[model samples]
Structure formats: C-alpha cells, structure tokens
Target: MTSPDEDRRTGAVHAVAAYGLWGMLPLYFVTLAPAGSLEILGCRILFSVVVAAILIRWQHGWGRMRTALRDRRVMLTLAAAAALIFVNWLTYITAATSGHVVETSLGYFINPIVTVLLGVVVLRERLRPLQWAAIGVSALAIVVLVVAYGQVPVIALTLAFSFGLYGLLKRQVSGRVDGLSGLAIETILLIPAAGLLIAVVSSWGQLTLLDHGPVHFALLAFSGIATLVPLLFFAGAAKRLPLAHLGLFQYLAPILQLLTGVLILHEPMPATRWIGFAIVWLAVFMLVADVLIVGRRGRA
Candidate 1:
C-alpha cells in the first residue's frame, strides 16, 4: 500500500494533468475554427455520449446511472445541470474562437467568487469578513472591466454564473451521482438537442465536420474523449486530495488560458484591462488566504 505522502504526490500529478488539459482547451478549440461554435458544441456533446458510454461499460456504472435516472429529483437536478453546462460550453467555445479567450479566463478566475456568492444567495450561507471583502473587490474589478471595455463583459459573466449554477446543481445530487455517471446522464439528456443542433447547422450548409479534412474531422469526432479524460483525471485527483488542495489546482486552467491569450494568441490586452485583471487577482489572493487560514484553524 502507498503511504499518505505518495498518494498525495500522485494526486498532485493527476491534478496538474487535469488542469493542464483544461488550460490548453483554448488552443484545441482554436484549431476547430471555421466550424461554428454551435456545431462544435453539438458535436462535443454527441461524441461525449459515446465516450461516456464506453466508460460506463468499462466501469460498470450502468446500475448507478439507472438508479439516478429513476429518481425524479436527481433527474431534475441533472437536467438543469445539462442545460447549464451546455450554456457554459457554448459560451466558452465562442469566446475561444472569437478572440475573447482572455475574457473567458477572467470568467473562470472569478468563478470561485461567484460560487461563494451563490452559496450566500441560494444556500443562505454566511460568509466570513474576508470572503465579503473578496467579493467586494471582485465586484470592483468587474466595474473596472466594464469601464475598460466600454460594455459589460457578457461572455465572462455568462461563463462564470452558468458554471457556478451548474456546480450548485451538481452538488445537490453529488451523493447519488459519481462523476462518470453524472456526466453520462447529462450527455444522454443532451443527445436529442445535440442531434437537432447538428441537423440545423447542416441544413444551413454551415457544417464543417467533413470539409475540414481527415485530421480536423478526427478531432471533431474525438471531442468526447477530450472531454472525458480530464474529468477522469480530476475524479482521480479528488479521491486522493483534500478539497482545499483541489480548489487550489482549479486556478491552473485560467492562468494558462490567460497566458495563452496574451502570449500565444496575441490578443490585445490594454493597460486598463490589465488593471482590472490585477484587481481580480488581488481578490483571488485574498480568497485563497482566507481558505488557508480557515483550514489551519479547523485543523487546530
């Protein structure tokens, strides 16, 4: 048997691998361009169903999936989750393809704050003083960004709230739903919509899946695998790591996305935008510090 330290080391590696894949997703989505965001989203959902099926068979999770499907509350919760994730995926794909990858990164950067806010509003949870301060700073950052862009950052807000709400829904059914089973259920629920979307896009002669050559077609077909692998890695990491440790790893993706947007994609980042992001980063630091302090106190 492995020692605790060894398990932690392994979990850290899995966490890095998961977040690294997520961070590089902007690059992957960029390669799928000329394919419309809706089409890509549809195909991703379609393919993910296949991959989830294979995983269900491999892991013998059909029983759990069946149980989850039979429960009215679970199905309702997952249905909402499916819709929220659909929105999040579509928005992220659009942003990545439309030169707003940096803003997308910002959305994820503030997701923890949004999650906390949702807890306060939806769950009636109380926040510590630091959490309140972080939220206030995050709000200020958004105001700064609105001024810098001369409009609300719709893409970022959409991604943040959609994902935050998705997490909330998932949490409701967490006890009954394993990661693979939950994803499989969500994808299954989305299959009809995904099919209709593909049909509509094809009817318009805008479908690029076949026109993009073999490599691109293959990439589109394998979108399901791309979606599933990182999630599996994340599940592995979650099983071995503390929630706080996993929370820290969640920031890796957006940081890489921000770097990719600025360095590799060469998207314009003006001084005002930088100032807004700096404020968000400051809020993030405060949030992290609060988590650490609370964790230490709990341990004490």
Candidate 2:
C-alpha cells in the first residue's frame, strides 16, 4: 500500500499537470478561430471518440465500458452527464474564441462554489459557517457583475452550472465507470450527432477542416489529445488525493486562466469587473481556508 504522504505528493503532481494543461487551453482554442463553435464542438467529439477508443483499448478498459453500457442506470446517468459536458464544451469554446476569455476564466473560478452549492441542495450535505460565508460572498460577486454589466454573466453562469451538474452526475456513478471508459462512452454517444454536424457544416462550405490547410487539420485532430490528457491526469490525481486536497488544487486552472486572459490575451478588466472579481477571490480564499482548517483539525 502507498503511504499517505507519497500518495498526496503524487496526487498533487498529477493535479497540477492537469490544471496547468487546462489553464493553457485558451491558447489552444485560439488556433481554431473562425471555426464555428458548433463545428469545433463536432470535431472535438469525433476526435475525442477516436482518442478515447484507443485509450480504452490500450488500458484494457473495454470490460468496464461494457459493464457501464450494460447497466441501464449508468448509461442514463452518463447520457445526462454527456449532454451537460457537451454544453459546457460548446460554451467554453464559444467563450474562448469569441474574446470572452476573462468570462471563461471567471466561470471556472466559480465552478467549485457551484459544486458546493449543488452538494448542499442535491446531496443534502451540510456546510460549515465559513463555507456558507464563502457562498454568500460568491453570490455578492455575481450580483455585482450583473449590476455592473447591466446583464447577467451568462457565459460564466452557464459554464459553472453545466459543469457542476455534470460533476454531480459523475459522482453518482463514480467507481462504476472508469474515467477513460466513461469518456469513451460519452463521446461515442455524441458521435452520431457529431457526424450529422460535420455533414451539415460540409454542405454549408464552412467546415474549417476542408479549406484551412494541413495546420488546421492537425489542430482539429489534436483536439482529441487536448481533451483526453488532462482528464487522465485529473483521474490519476483524484484516485490518490484526499477530496479536500484535490479541491485545493482545482483553483490552479482558473487562476492561470484568469492571468492568461488579462496578461496574455489582453482582455479588458474594467474597474467594476475587477471589483466583482476581487469579491470572488475573497470567497475562494475563505473556501480554501475553511477546507484547510477543517482538515487540520480532523488530523489533530
């Protein structure tokens, strides 16, 4: 058996690599510009299915995949999760490519908070005082963004809720479904729709893969790799780390994404948006601190 310390160290390494890759994804999406979001999404599904099939085969995960498919409940749950993830992917790609990188970053930053809220409502999980306070602060931040923008932050909210729900469903079928196998199943479920999309896009003469030359072709194919690698790392980490520790590392992706938006992409951060973001940061700090403090006390 692995020692706890060793497990945690390995988990941290995997988690960081996963989130770091995720954080850098905006740069990757930039390469797909001018490709319609739906088109790109179709390509993602198609190529991801291919990659996942290879992974499942290589890892000898077909047994698990077969088991999951045979189980009606698992299939139903993964189907829902697949739909949610598709929405999340579409929204994220649209946001990143449409100059909403900052909003995309903010969406991920808010996801953990949304997950916590989902746990409260869906799982009947209890929250400590600090957790409640964190949620309240996060709510305040959203209100501020709404008031300042004179509209709701739809991009951020959609990403958060969709992904949060996906996570919730995945939690229900956790050990029953292996990550690579589950991904393969989801992409396989989406492949028909993806094929339909490609045909439609091809008829419209707007398929980037058709006219954008070899570079575009390669990038589109690379989308599968981009999608799968981080997932593998995240799964490796989750298996080894405590939930609290894993939760702590989740912030890395968003923080890097936020910086990438502001510093690399040069997205505008107006004063009002900054204020709202500051409040959100405070909430995240509280949440992280709460987890750490409670974890320490439990250890004691």
Candidate 3:
C-alpha cells in the first residue's frame, strides 16, 4: 500500500493536471472557431456519451450506472445536474470563443463565494466572519464592474451561478454516483437536447463540423475525451486529498484563464476592470486565510 504522503503527492499531481487542463480550455475552444457555440456544445454532448460508454466499460462501471439509473432520486438529481452543466458549458464556450475569456475567468474567480452562499441558503450552513467579509468584498467588486461597464456582468454572473448550482446538485448524488457514472448519466440525459441543438444549428447553416477539414472534425470528435480526462483526474484527486487542499487547487484554473486572456489573447483589460479583479482577489485572499486559520485551529 502507498503511504499517506505518497498518496497526497499523487493527488497533488492529479489536481494540478485537472485544473491545468481546465485553465487551458479557453485556448482549445478558441481553436474551434467557425464552429458556433451551439454546434460545439451539441457535439460535445453527443461525443461525450460515446467516450463515457468506452470509459464505463473499461472501468466495469456498467453495474453502477444501472444502479444509479434505477434510483429515481439519483436520476432526478443527475437530470438537474445535466441541465445546469449544459448552461455552464454553453456559457463558457460562448465566452471563450467570443473574446470574453477574461470575464469568464472572473466568473470562476467568484465561484467559491457563490458556493459559500449556496451552502448558506441551500444547506443552511453558517459562515465564519471572514467568509461574510469575503462575500461583501465580492459584492463590491460586482458593483464596480457594473458601474465601469455600464451594465451587469451577465456572463460572469451566469457562469458563476450555473456552475455553483451544478456543484451543489452533484454533491446531492455524490454518495451514490461515481464521477464517470454520474457524467455518463448526465450526458445521456442531455442527448435529446443535444440533438435538437445540432438540428437547429444545421438549419441555420452554422454547423461547421463538416465544413471544416478533417483536422477540425477530429478536434470536435476529441472533445469528449478532453472533457472526460480532467474530470477523472479530479475524481482521483478528491479521493486522495483533503478538501482544503482540493479547494485551494481550484484557483489555478481561473488564474491560468486570466493569464491566457490578457497575455496570450490580448483581450483588453482597462483600469476599472483591473480594479474589480483586484477586489475579487482580495475577497479570495480572505477566504483562503479563513480556511487556513480554521484548519489550524481544528488541528490544535
């Protein structure tokens, strides 16, 4: 058996790989240019089912999938998860391809705050003082962005809330569902909607999957594997790492995304937007500090 230290090291590696892949997703999505978001989303859903099937068979998880499907509660929860993830994926794909990657990064930056708020509202969990302060700072940051942009940051908010709720729904069925099985069920649930999207996009003549050469078609086909690999890594990490460590690792994705937007994509970030992001970063700092302090006290 591996020692705890070795397990943690392995988990750290997995966590880094997962978040790193997620961070670089904007780059991948951008490369699929000429393929509209709906078309890409549809293909992602359809092909993910194919990939999930192969993985399920490889892992011998057919039994678990059947068990989950038979449980009404599990199926309902996963159905809800499927819808939320559909929204999250669509929003992210649109933003990434439309040069709004910075704003997309902002959405994820505040996701921890949204998750905390959901815990308060949905789980009836109490927050520490720092957590409350962090929320306040995040709120201020939103106000700053609204004033600066002369409108709500709809993309950021939508991505944040959709993903936050998605995470909550996943938690509801986590006990009964393995990551691969859960994803398989969720993707299966989305098949009809995915088909409809493909039909609609094709009608509009915006479906570029076939118009593009074989290279583009191959990339679209590989979307399923791209989606599944990181999730599997995340699952492995979660099983091996402490929650606190996992939570901290979540920041890597947004940070990389922000860098990709500003440094690589040359997305403009004016002073006001920088200030808003700085405020959000401050809030994130408080949350991290709170976690560390509370964890230390627990150890003590």
RMSD per model, one decimal: 0.8, 1.4, 0.8
Residue range 77-186, candidate 3, lDDT tens digits: 99999999999999999999999999999999999999999999999999999999999999999999998778999999999999999999999988998889999999
- The worst-scoring run of ten residues by lDDT in candidate 1 lies at 29-38
Question: Model 1, clash count?
Answer: 0
lDDT of each: 0.95, 0.91, 0.95
Question: What tens digits encode model 1's per-residue C-alpha lDDT throughout 1-300?
Answer: 999999999999999999999999999988887888889999999999999999999998889989988999999999999999999999999999999999999999999999999999999999999999999999999999999999999999999999999999999999988989999999989999999999999999999999979998998987898899999999999999999989999999999999999999999999999999999999999999999999999999
Q: Which of 1 and 2 is ahead in lDDT?
A: 1
Candidate 3 deviant stretches above 4 angstroms: none
Question: What range of 10 consecutive residues in model 2 has the weakest lDDT sum?
Answer: 29-38
TM-score of each: 0.98, 0.96, 0.98
**Model 2 Cα displacement at 239 (Å)?**
2.2
**Model 1: which residue pairs collide?**
none
Residue 60, model 2: lDDT of 86
Better of 2 and 3 by TM-score: 3
